[model samples]
Target: MSRLLTAAAVAVTLLFSQNALAEKVSVEELQTGLDHPWAVAFLPDNQGMLITERSGSLRYWRQGKGLSQPIIGVPKVWAERQGGLLDVVLAPDFTQSRRVWLTWTEVDNNGRAGAVVGYGTLSDDNARLTRVKTVLRQQPALSSGANLGSRIAFDGDGFVWITFGDNFHAETAQDLSALTGKIVRLNADGSVPQDNPFVNKTGARPEIWALGVRNPQGIALNPWTQEIWESEHGPRGGDEVNIPRKGKNYGWPLATWGLDYSGEKVPGSKGGEVAGTEQPAFWWKVSPAISGMAFYNSARFPQWKNSLFIGALKEKNLIHLSVNGDRVTEKERLLSDRGERIRDVRMGPDGYLYVLTDERNGKLLKVGLAE
Candidate 1:
């Protein structure tokens, strides 16, 4: 018995030692002092980047130079808890059109606010946005404050996918008639695609591509598989990563692996196994508050090529997951407590992993393999 116990201790020690080694290659901070930065996108022609802050401002960054002054002409925003100016994406044909998309919280009738997606044209210098127009808006605005999980991704097909939260209305997730807690597909001009799953269905929101999500803050498209993936925050535990499919229900408030914040039983049970709802590709038992995700397609991180990198706001780290086709086989936690909240992760054009920190004074960090 003593021999067996000794062997077990040695095995545990080796496991911890391996994890520590993996954490060593992470990059230290390169720049700092950004103000509550949310989303980041690279310019197609140059090495500079455009970044958005939660306070309704946009800033520019060049390679050697630091952050530029807040770019003017951003639309006025309704900044509130979990709301305000959010994501930004460059058009695929940006060289010719100079178009960009933005998502934010907008105040509507009845003095309530909801999420909205819009488009704009970049100025001659690419430093300012002009001709802003609303492309999509959430319906039946909620009266109280809650989750607004807004993230956007542009598929190669020229269509855009937008993910919405339940707005604290858990029951709204299962309701296809509403736009809350759903993945919506839209054309470049913010119109619903004619081939959407529910375009012809009566009483359903024509923009809905999939339904039944909680607070899906992270959305990305896998360049290799052409698949759409999302990461969402669960009630207290059950943080989930899902590959959304059209017309399928995702089993939100009605079913979950997580419990309520008070530790009481959730409505539907441990997992979503109902007749029509789909299951998550991966789920974390202890909630990490996943905020951003990107698939590593760069050649610089050869070992991480085709793997998914996720930003964890609650844990303040980057969570790396290995993907075999559609399934997540393993996970590694990186940069734990080394920085503040990680808001976004992207594979840069320069063949390095770029990260945006979320805080009153955030940072733009670059990660690559160590020498």
Candidate 2:
């Protein structure tokens, strides 16, 4: 009877804990008129923020000034299906250089498409981007339009890290010569680092730091460890959280907890593990289609310190994971009541959490702990 009572108590505690976070959270609309906003990069010193729309527009927003007209001088993008202007992040020396980097799907004259990285100096008046230049482009543009995983980040050593999808071609993920389904490390100016993992390998792309990811849309440097973490979309299920390392292979079609969209097994998958592939730090049996992520290291939400916040596109919610070292101790899903596909989650410089909804008229929401 004592054992039964203890089990019952644990069940009740767990139930209340899950609901508590939801009830104690608040969402406020900062901008309600966005169109399919994909990412957010907060400006230094709270100057403002830059938001990217998948339909090839960049909007600037300030605290009391509201959203500005679309910034001019953005590159022409292939804004069809899953292709478009994607991520925008400030250069590490942004305060001094006023430079911002961006990623987008670039199309060739023959109609082939691939993701590219570029940067432009933000004009002093904030009216336009000037001096734009291309930095890197995925090699051998392809005909496919889906799964262009174009997220960008800067590591502590000032190296640029960009993620790419397999372009609906899973066979190329393990190919050393292919740039798809890979995490690439490059210098600020898009030059391949001499210390890159595959630099000396024969016939390999020297920019590749890690390989074998599928539709990875989330990338963030863990504040505590300074290590990069990624979230990826699997076929039917099997969404994963990974800490990508140099030369590591994150098994894709060859090992997954998911089946093909047609209810068949993935061609080479025996299970969720292959001898040469690294295991995911965590995985979901049912995919949530995660996107942008941010690590919360603020005091505004005392209960949320050391938590990792991720956007859930398929589930239309936000996920919070309490992380200690590299282990996840708790997981909670928030904003299910709103029924919006979350496209991005970011912690603001002012210690508040921001989220982007993916919709025809999407929204930029400011999230906080309920007072």
Candidate 3:
């Protein structure tokens, strides 16, 4: 018995020790003093980056220079709990069009709030996002500010993909009439594309691409497959990564791997998969509060090539996933020692990974190979 116990103890110690050693990359603070920074997007032509703060300020950053002042021209945002300026991305044709896309919690009629998208030109001076216009807005805004899953990803087909939260309306996740809890697509000009699944369907939002989500905050396209991949927060656990499909339903409140905060099962949850709903490509037994994502497609990190990078708010670490086809072959937690709630992760043009830590005094960190 003593021999057996000694062997087991050694194995456990080795397991944790191995994990600690695996996080070998070094992190450098690139910029700081961002108030609850939400997301960051690289600008075209190597100009700089667009960083959005939850307080409705759009700041710019450039290497060797510093963080620029908050760019002007943004409208008011509902900057309460879990609501604010969310994701920001540049149009794929930004080099030619000079357009920047932004998503935020917009105050709507009756004091309700909802996820809304808009675009405007980044001024020549890099000081303003002018001519801003609303591109899309989820329907029937609600008074609740939680679960506003707002993230932006440009699909390979020249369509813009946006995730609308279940809006704390869990039941609406199963309702096609509601735009909340859905992945929606739209043209660059905010027009409904004719190819959308529900373009002419009755009682359905033409922009909806997929439905039945909780609060998806991380969104990215798989570079190898050009597939739309997303990450969402579960009820209390069961954070997930899914490939939102055309007109498909990703079972949410009706079928989940998580229980309610009250320690009770969510009504209609079938414990993960329901007969007619889609399953997550990956899910966590314990919620990591996944927020942002990026695919390591650069040669600068050979070991991380083609891997998916995720930011965790509750876990306070960067997750490294080795994705093979539809399955996540492995997952590694990185940078947990920094103890910052990661808000966003993006790949810089210079082959480095940039991260935004969510906080009143947020920071931008660059992750690269250790010297």
lDDT, model 1, position 109: 62
With a 3 Å backbone cut-off (N, CA, C), the pairs that clash in candidate 3 are: none
Residues 267-293, candidate 1: write the lDDT tens digits.
655454665677899988898888889
- At residue 1, candidate 3 shows an lDDT of 18
Candidate 1: clashing pairs of residues:
none
Tens digits of per-residue lDDT for model 2 on 46-82?
7889999999998888766777888999998989887
What does candidate 3 score in Cα RMSD to the true structure? 8.5
Cand. 2 Cα-lDDT: 0.85
For all candidates, what are the clash counts?
Answer: 0, 0, 0
* Reference-based TM-score of each model: 0.91, 0.93, 0.93
* Sequence-dependent TM-score of model 1: 0.91
* Rank order (by lDDT, best first): 2, 3, 1
| Candidate 3, poorest ten consecutive residues by summed lDDT | 3-12
The CA lDDT at 213 in model 3 is: 94
Query: Residue by residue across 1-371, what tens digits does model 3's lDDT show?
Result: 11011211111011112254364676777676788999999877788788899988888877666777778888779898888898889999888888999999877667789988899998778898788999888887873789999999998888889999988889898888888899998887889989888889898888889999999989999988899899999988989999988888899987899989888998778777788899899998889999998888998878787699999999898888898878884457777777899999999998888999998878888787664
Judged by lDDT, which candidate is best?
Answer: 2
